[model samples]
Target: MSDAAGDRDTDRGRDRGRGGSAPFAPHEWQIAWRYMRARRREGGISVIVWYALVGIALAVGTLIVVMAVMVGFRAEFTDRILGAEGHARIYPIPVVQDDGRRVSAIDDYDALAERIAAVPGVIRAAPMIEAQVLVSRGSANSGAVVRGMRISDLQDLPYVAHPELSEGSLEDLTHGIALGEGVARELGAYVGDMITMILPGGQATPFGMAPKIKTFELVYVFRVGRADVDRSRVYMTFEAAQDYFNKGDTADQVEALMAHPDLLGSRANPTEADAALIRAAGHNRVLWTWKDANGAFLSALDVERAVMFMILSLVVVIAALNIISGLVMLVKNKGRDIGILRTMGLTQGAVMRIFFLCGAGIGTLGTAIGVGLGILFVIYIDPIFDVVNFLAGGGIWNPEIRMLTEFPAELRWQDVAASAGLALALSYGITLFPARRAARLDPVEALRYE
Candidate 1:
C-alpha cells in the first residue's frame, strides 16, 4: 500500500479511538448531572430539596401510621364482635308469636339445626330465642335482652358462651339468668339479688298483668367491655325462655358459628349458600351474616380510610410539584448544551429522554428515601407513639383509647406497593410536559440567544 493510503488509515484509527471514548467523555447526561450537583452545592437549591424531602417524608410517615391506626381499631373491634357474636346468625323473619290462636309450630327445627351445622364452614348451629323486656328490682329499672340458649349447644361456641366470665359460673346460667356488667350496674342488682322481668307482650291476666312475671335470682355477672352488649345481655335456659316468652315448642331463631368469619359474606350469592345449609339441615330458614347486621359501620370505616388517604396524598403531590420546578430550572439552565447537541446529532427524542430521566431520577430517589424513612418510623412507632402520648399530658404513656391502648401498626405490603407505584406514576407524569418542551426547542434560536 502507498504511504498516503497508510496515513489515511492512521487518521481513521484515531477517529475510531476518539468515538469509542466519546460516551465516557462529558456529554448531555454529565451536563445534566453536573447541574444537579451544582444545585446541591448551592445552599438555596439544596435547602429547597431538603424542604421537599421533609415534606414528602412527613406526609408518607404520617399516612402510613394513621392508616395502620385505623386498621388496628377496625380489626380490634371486629374481633371483639366476632368473639361476642357468631360470624353469621339465622333467624325467623317474623318471630312466631304465641297468640294460642292456631300457631304453626316448627317441628323441623331440630333437623334444620343439624343441617346448618353441616354447612361447609359452619362449626355449629344452635337454636336461639331472644326477648327484650324491662327488668325491675324495687323501683330500679333497666331494659334488657334475654337470650335463651341450651347449655349443651352453647358449650360448642366458647367465644360467646364463656367469654372471660368476670363474676359468674356457666352453670349458673342454667338455673338463673346471668347479668351483663352494665345491666347489673343499672339495675343496682348483684349476684343473689332477685329481679322481676316484665315481657313486653305478656298476656294480661284477669288479675291484671300476670303472664308469668317470675322473679329470677341473678347468679352471674359478665363484663364484655362493649357498651351496647354489656348493658343488655342476660342468658337464661332455653326451656325457661320458652315457657316465659310463650315460645312453646319453637325457637325465635337459630345462630350459626363459622370457622372463617371474613369469608362469611364472600359468596357471590349468599341465598344459595344459606339454601345449601338449610337443605343440609333439612329445614328452610333465613341466614344473616355479620355483614348484613353491621354493614353501615364497616362501610363508614372504609370511607373514612379512603378520605384520609386522599387527603394525606395531597402532601406528596405538593412535594412532587417541587420536583417539577427543579427540573424546569435544570432544562432552562442546560438550554445551550441541548442546542449544541442538536447541532451535532442528538435527536429531539433523545433530548426528551435526557430530561425525562432526570425527572424520573428525582422521583425514584425521593420515593426510595421516603419509603425507607416510613418503614423506619413504623419500626420505632411504639416509642414515637409514647412520646406523643406523653406530650398530650398522659404520664409516661397512657394507652390511646381512640382505637387501642397501645400503638398497633400493621404495615400492609399492598399499601407500600400502592404508595411507591403512585409516586413513580406522578413523577413520570410531571416530566412529560416539560420534557416535550425541552425536546422541541429551536436549536438556532437557543444557540443565538446563548
Candidate 2:
C-alpha cells in the first residue's frame, strides 16, 4: 500500500512538471503557456494581443524597407560622385603675372606629379588641363569644360570607361575629340562630324581681339550616365589641349587616385596617400578632396537618413505601446489565476515571469514574422514595383530624373539586428509595469472578486 501511494505521488508530480492539469507546481512557464492557449470563455488569451502582434509586425517590416532604400540611395549617389572625380586634386596657388592677374596654370607639373605618385597608398597621379571653351556644331553653341587627358589616363578612369562608344573607337580619340552624350545632344553633333572650338584666351590680331578657333572631328560619343557630366564635359588629348589653350609643358591641376577613396578629407585623419599629397604639394598649394567638393551634399544625405530613421522609429514605439495595453488587460483578466498560483506557493517573481513571457511571446513572434516579411519584400521589390507600374498604365519612372528604372534597396545585418533588439527591448520594457502589478496582487482580494 505504501509503495503504491509513493508511485501515485511521483506520477502526479511528473504530470504537473509537463504542464498537465496542475495550475502551479513551481511551473510558471507551464501556467504562462496555458494562459496563452486558453479560450475567451476559459479566460485565455485576449483579442488585443493579436492586434499588438499585427501592429509590431507591420512597423518592423516598414522600418526595414525604408532603411534599405535610404542606404541604397546614398550608395548610388556616392558611387556616381566618386566615379566622375579623382580622390583628390592638387592645384597650384594662382601665380601673379606681370599684369597682376592671377593664372591657375601649374608649371613643372610633371615633376610634382611624379613626387605625388611615389606616395604610400597613392595608386596613380595624372596631370590634367581644364579650360572653358565655346563648342559650336552647325547652329547650336554651348559653353563646355574641355578636359585634356592622356589617352592612357582617360582609359584608366572608371567613369570614362563606363560609357559605351556609340560610334568610332577609342584609338581615334587621340586624333580628335570625345564628346559626352549630353554635349552631343545639345550641340546636335555626331561621330565623324566636325565641331568648332573657340578658346576664350585669344591671340592678338590686327583687330581688337581674335578668339583662337579650331575645328576637330568628333571621333567618339560617350554617355557617363550623369546628366551634368554628359552635358558639360568634353575630352581631348593632353598635347592637343595644351596647344589649343596656349599652355606649353604645364597643366591646370594634378589629380591623385587613392587606394581608399573614402578617406578623402581635409583633416589630420586623412589617409597616407592624402597626407603625402598634402606634404608634397606644400601649404601654398590648394588640395581639394572629393569629400571637400561634396561635403554639403553628403551632409544633407546623412541628416536625411537620420531624420527618416527617427520618424519611422515612432511606428515601432506606438506598436510597443500596444503591447503595454494588451498586457495590462491580461493582468486584470488573469487576476484570479494569479491569486490561486500565489496561494499554491508560486513566488511573486514567478508571477511576474508568467506575464513577462506572455508579452514577450507576442513581441518575439511578431518580430520574427516581420523580419521574414521584410526580407522577402526587399528581395522582390523590383518585380513588385514593375507590377504596380504596369497596373498604373504609364511609365512611373521618369528617365530624365531617375537613372535607375527600379528603386534600389541594400540590406545590412546590423540594421536588422538593431531593429529587432529595439523592438524586443521596448516590448520587454512596457511589460514591466503590468507584470509587477500582477505579481503584487493580494491573493485574498483577487479570490474575493472572482
Candidate 3:
C-alpha cells in the first residue's frame, strides 16, 4: 500500500513538473477534470452538480424563449397595425366655418395624392374616405368602417393584396365592395354575395333624416392579419365612397406608405424634409406617423419585456446558487486529494483554478445547451405551438383577444449573447468563494483530519 501511494505521488510530481506552478497550466486542467469523474471506489461529480446543470439550462432556455416571443409579438403587431393603416397619414387642415365650426375635408385630393407620392422616400400616397356604417347579409348584421380607395392603391398594400389571402381580382374592386376577413365571417358573407350597407344621416329627406342604404357584390375577401382591423374595415372605390358619404369631390385623408417607416422623423432620415417637400407641393395637412398611432401599445410591450427579463433573471440567480452548493460539496469531498496534491508541489492558485474549472465547466456546458435549445425552439416554434395548442384543445392562441392568430418567436443573437453573458457572470461569481476556500486549505490539517 505504501509503494502504491509512493508511485501515485511520483506520477503526480511528474505531471506538474512539466508546467511548474503556472496559472491554468495543462496539468491543472487535467487534475481538475479528473476530479470531476467517478471511479468504482471514489466519489466524483456531485448530485448537486447535475441538479445545478439542469436548473441553469432550464432557466436560461426559458428566459431566451420568453424574450424571443416578446420581440416577435412586438414586431408582428407593429407590422400589422402599420399595414392596416399606412406608415403616415396626411389629414387636411380643417377649414373654419363662418359660424366657428371646423369643416375638415381634403378637396381635389387626387392631385395632392399624386404630388405627395412624388416626394422622396414616399412609396405611395392614396386618397381615401372613411365612414362608419352598419352592414348586413340576411339575419347577420355588424358595424363596420367603410374605406373608399383606388384599386391600384389597395393592391400596393402588401398585407392586404396577397394572392393567397384574397379570393378576387383587383380589377373588380371598384365594381364591388371588399370585405375584411373578420367582417365577412361575422356576416357569413362570401365573394359574389350582396351585402346591404346603411350609412346613418347619409341623406336628408322630408322625414327629417334618412339613412342611405345600398347593396354591392362582395367581390373581394381579404385579411390584413390584424384581428381588429379585419373585423372593422370594408373597402370600396373612391368614387362610390364619395357618392355614398356625400363628400362631393373630397377625401377624408391621404395616407402615404414610406420606404422606411421606422426612420421617419428620426435623425437618420429626418422626415421633416419629406414634410417640407409635401408642403412645398401646395398642400395644407396635419401629419401623423404609425409611431404616433400606436406609441402607447408599443410602450406597454417594451415595459413588459423589461419586467419579464428582470423577473426571469431571478431564476438564473437561484440556479447559480446550486453552483455554490455543488462546489462546496466538491471541495469538502476532495480535501484528502487536495492535501496530497498540495504536498506534491501544487500551488494554492493551481488548486483554486482546478475547482473553479469544475463549477464553471458545468455552467458553460449548461449555457451552451440552453442556447441550442432556445434556437431550436425559435426555429420550430410554429409546429411546437400547434402541438401545444392541440394538447390544450386549441386554447393557446385566440385572435380576438391577442390580436394575432399564431404564436411567434424571433431569436436575436444579441439576446442570446446577453443570456450567455448573464449565466457565465453569475456562474463565475458564485464559484469563487468555494474555490478560494479550497485553495486556502492547509495541507497538513486536511491530511490530518482525513
Candidate 4:
C-alpha cells in the first residue's frame, strides 16, 4: 500500500480504537461476548454480574405484576360502576324551598329521556325515582336505596334486566319490589315474600314527624356482582314510587346508558366528542358523566401506580449499580491486558465498547426473563391469588369492603415495554462510567509495576 494510504488507515484505526472496525462491528462483539465469560481469577466479579441480572429480572417482573393489578383494579371498578350507575345522569335543576330545602322534580322527563336516548352512542335513558329507605321482611332488616322505574325502563337497565345478571322474575316488578341478592340473603326473603319499606321524616304529626310505611311483594333479586351495590339496591315500579314518595307525577332524574361507558370523558376519550351531541339532542340541564363521581378514586390509583413504579425501579437501578462494582473489579484485574492491547494499537473506543457490551448483555437477558415471568404471573393471577389467600387461611379480601369478589390482573404492553426499557436503560447507562475509565487507562501507568 502507498505510504499516504497507510497513514490514513492508521489514523482511522487510532480514532476508533483497536481495529477501528465499524460501529459495533462483529469482532468487537465477539471480543465483548468472550470477556463476559469469567475466568477463575475473575469469579467474584462474575458472581456480581449474575446477581445484577437476577436483580434486574426480579425488579422488572415485580413492576409488571404490580402495574397489572392496578390496571385490573381500574378496569373492574369501572365495569361495576358503569353497570350500577350508568354512563351519564341528567338531573333537574333543584329549586330551593322557602325553608332552604332543595327539591328536585323533573317534570315531563319521559319524553326528554327519549330524546337523550336518541343521541349518538347512547343506549338507554330511563326516567327514575331514587331514594334511601330501610327494608324489612319477617325478622330481618337492612338499609337500601330504592330505584323506581317503569317495567319497560327496567328492561333497559343492563344488569337489572339481564336474565344472567338477575334471579327470579321481573314479571311482577310493576306491582311488587325487586331486592338485591345480598338484601334477600340478609332478610332471608324469598321471591314471593312480602317486604316492608320504611321511609323516615314523613307526615307532619302532633309530635315532630312520623315515618311512612309500605309493604310490597318481592318479585325478583338481582346480583350485580358488586358486594356493596348488590346488598343495597332495591327496585320498584315508577307508579308505586310516585305514590310512596308523594312526588305527584314528576320524576327525580334520567339515567342515560352509553354503548361505551368507559369511554365517556374528556382527556381524548372517544365519547367526549359525543357529549355535545347528547346535550344538543333535546335537554341540557344538570348533567354529569360517570367520571365526575369516581374520578378521585381512579386518579388515586394512577398516582399509586406511578409511585409504585418509581419505587420498584430502584431495584433495577441497584442491580445496574452492581455492574459498576463488577466492571470496576474487572478493570483492575484486566489492567495488564488493557496495557498490552493499547501498546498493540488497540483503540480506546473498542475497549470502552467491549465493557459496555458486557453490561448490555446482562441487562437484555434479565429484562427478557422478567417480562416473560410478569406475563405468566398476570395470566395465572387468579390461581396465585387463591393460593395466597389459602396460605393466609382465607379472608384476605372482603367483597363488601373491596367491592370485588376476586383478585384481578390485566397485562398491558405499554407497562411491559416501560419496565424493560427502564431496566435496559439503567443497565446501559450505568455501564458508561466504568467503560470510559477502562478506555482512558494510560498504558504506561497500567503496566508500570507489571
Candidate 5:
C-alpha cells in the first residue's frame, strides 16, 4: 500500500513537471514563477525583485543607447573625413640630402598620376599641390593650407563639388580662389573681395629675400561641416598654384579616389585598395591612405568607445550581483518548501533548475524591455532633442564644434544581441551558487524547525 501511494505521488509530480495546469511549469518553472508572483494576501512583489528588474532594464537600455550614438558619430566622422580627402594619396618620397635638405616635388607626376588612374579600383587620380601659406584680408591674417588642383578634377570630387556655396561660383575660378566658410567668416571677407597670399619662397634680392606676395579674388565660399577644414583650407587652380609656388611641371602629390570607398583601411590594418595603390605607385614613391593620415584621431575614437563600453558594463554586473543576493534570500525563505519537495522524491538537479528559471526569467524579460526601449529611443532621438532644445529656449548644439546639429544614433542588431546575451549570461551565472546551496539542504533539518 505504501509502494502504491509512493507511485501515485511520483505520477502527480511528473504531471506537474509536464506543465498540466500548473502555475509555473515544468515543475521547476512552476515553482520559480510562484516565488516571483505575490500571493493575494501579500498584494505586491518583493521590493528587492523589483529593484533587480528595473536595474537590469536601465543598465541594458543605457548601454544600447550610448553605443548606438557612438557608432553613429563614428560613421558620420569617417564619412566626412573620407569625403574631404580621397581614399588614398600617392606622393613622391622626399629625397633627403646628406645636409638634411629635402626636395618635396614629385618627378614625372603627370605620367605617374596617369598610371595610378589606370589601376583597378581607382576611379580618378589627379595631381595636386598642398602648401601652407599665410592668408590675409584687410589686416586680419590666418595661417591656411592652400590646395591647388585642376578645375575639372576638383569638379569631379563629390565633396568639393556638391557644397551649396553661400557666396560665389567655381566657374569664376580662373585665377581666383575659393575660401572655406570659416575662413571667410574669420577674415570678414566676402566673394569678390581680394585676399593676399604670402608664400614662403621668395626672390633673392640685394636686400636679402623678399616673401612672395600675391592677391586673388575670392570666387567661392564653401562649408563642409568640419571646423578645421572650413577654417584652414582654400582652393585654387593648379596652374595658379604652380605659378605662385614656382613649380613648372612637378606636383606635390597624387590624390586618388577608389571605386569602393568603404574598403579604405583603418589604423590597425591596411586595406586591399591601399595595397593596390602602393603597387601601382611603385616602391620609390610614398603612398598614404586616408586612414594612415587620420589614424591617430580614429584610434582615439576607438579607445573611447571601448572604455565607455567597459564602464557601462559595470552597471550590468552590479545588477547581476543583486540577482545573486535575491536568489540566496529566496532559498532561505523557501527552505521548508525545498525540503518537502526533496522528501517527496524531487531530485537535487530539479531544485537547482527551479532557481535558475527564476533568475533567467528576470534577465530575459528585462533584456527584452531594455532592447525595445533602446530602439525606440534611437528612432525618436532627433525629435526628442528638438523638444529638449525648445524647452531649453535656445540651441544647445553648436554646429561649429559638434559638426552635427542633431543627435545621431544608429541601432545595430549585433550590438543589441551582444548586450542581451551578456546580461542573460551574468544572470544565469550568479544563480548557480545559491541554487546549489538550496539543492544540498538537509531535508530533515530544514523541515524540523517548521
Candidate 6:
C-alpha cells in the first residue's frame, strides 16, 4: 500500500513537471480556461447543475412567451379596433353642441383633402360626419353613432377590407343604409327592415320642440366584433348624413388611415409627421393618430410588458445565487490545491481570476442554454398558442374582432438582445463575492489543514 501511494505521488509530480510551463504562457486566458476546465471537472457537473440550467431556461422562455402573447393580444386587438373605426381622424376645432343653431365653414375641403392625400405616407384621406342618433324599428329603439362616409374616399382603408356582409352589399351603402350586426340583433331588425333615425336638429320648428327624423331601408349589416362599435355604429351615404345632420354641404371631420399602426408617437416616420402636419394646418382642425385614438389600451400593453420584465428578472437573480453557492463549494473542496498554487508563486489576483473563470464558465453555459430555449419557444409560438387555445375551448378565437382573427407574432431582435445581455451580465456579476473570498485564503492555514 505504501509503495503504491509513493508511485502515485511520483507520477503526479512528473505530470505537474510536464505542465509547469502551461501556466507561464503569454495567453493567460488560455491557461486560465484550461485550469478552470480541470477544476470544474473535479467539482463534477452534477444533476443539480442541469436542474439549475433548466430552471433558468424555463423561466426565461416563459417570460419571453408571455410578454410576446401580451404584445400579440394588444397588437391584434388594436388593429381590429382601428379597422372597424378608422385611423387618425381629424375633427374641426370647437365642436358645437346639439343646440338649436348651425355652425358653417366655407373652407375648400376638396382641395384640402387632395393636398392631405399628397402628404407622404398618408394612405387614404376622406371626409366624415359623426352624430349620435336614436334609431328605431317598430317599438324597439337603439342609440347609435351615424357616420357619413364616401365609398370612393375610404377605398384604401382596412375598414372596408373583407367587410362582413350580414345583409346588403357595399354598392347599396349609398342608396339605403348599413347597420352593424350587433345593432341589428339588438333592434330586432334584419336586412330588409326599414328603420327611422332621429337626429337632434339644430333648428327649432315653429311648432314646439323638434328633431330631424329620416327613414331608410336597412341595406347592409356588417360585423367587426368590437362590442362598443358593433352595437352602436350606423353607416350612411354622405348626402344622407348631410341632410340629416343639417350640415347642408359640410362634413364635421376628415378621417385618414396610415400604413403601420405600431410605429406611433416614438418613431418619427413620415406617416406620423404628415398626420401631424395636417393637424397643425391652420384650418382649425384637430388631427389624431391611432395612438391618440386608443391611448388607454396601448398604455395598458406597455405597463404589462414592464411588469413582466421586472418579475422575470428575479429568475436570473436566483440563478446567480446558485452560481455563487457552487463556486463557494468548489473553493472549499480545493483549499489545499489553492494553497499549493499560492506557494508556487501564483499571485492573489491570478488566484482570484482562476475562480472567476470557473463562475464565468457556468454563467456562459447556462446563458447559452437559456437563450437556446427562448429562441426555440419563440420560433414555434403560433403552434403553441393554437394548442393552448384549442385546449382552452377557443375563448379568444373571436375576441370582439377589434384586432385580428388569427394569432399574430413578431420576434424583434431587440427583445432577444436585451434578454441575453441581462442574463450574461447577471451571471458575471455574482462571481465577485466567491472570487474575492478564494483570493484572500491564508496559504499557511489551508496547507496545514490539508
Rank candidates by TM-score, best first. 3, 4, 2, 5, 1, 6
Provide TM-scores for the models: 0.75, 0.86, 0.90, 0.88, 0.85, 0.74
Model 3 pairs whose backbones collide:
none
lDDT for model 1 comes to: 0.71
Question: How well is each residue in 1-450 modelled by candidate 4, as lDDT tens digits?
Answer: 985465457647676653335667787788788778888888998898888888888889999999999999889888878766667877777789999989888887888887887777788888889999999987888999999888887776666777235667887887799988899999999888999999998656889878999889988988877887789999888988988988889999888888876666733343553465356444536667777777778889889989999998887798778888888888888899888887787667778888888878888898999999999999998999899999999998988888777787889999999999999889899999999999888878899999
lDDT of each: 0.71, 0.80, 0.83, 0.82, 0.81, 0.70
Which whole-number lDDT from 0 to 100 does residue 7 have in model 1?
41
The most accurate candidate by TM-score is: 3
Score candidate 6 by lDDT.
0.70
Going through the candidates in order, what is the number of backbone clashes in each? 2, 0, 0, 3, 2, 6
289-379, model 1: which lDDT tens digit per residue?
A: 8877776787798899889889878877887777677777667767897889777666565677777776777777778877777777777
> Considering every candidate listed, which one attains the maximal lDDT?
3
> Which scores higher on TM-score, 4 or 6?
4
Badly placed stretches (over 4 Å) of model 1 are 1-33, 38-41, 93-108, 136-140, 155-158, 161-165, 185-196, 201-204, 211-220, 223-225, 262-271, 281-284, 303-315, 334-357, 373-409, 435-450
The order of the candidates by lDDT, greatest first, is 3, 4, 5, 2, 1, 6
Winner on TM-score (2 vs 6): 2
Residue 203 of model 6, lDDT score: 50
Candidate 6 Cα errors over 4 Å, as ranges: 1-48, 81-86, 94-107, 118-121, 136-141, 163-168, 184-219, 223-226, 258-283, 340-354, 389-408
* C-alpha lDDT of residue 343 in model 4: 78
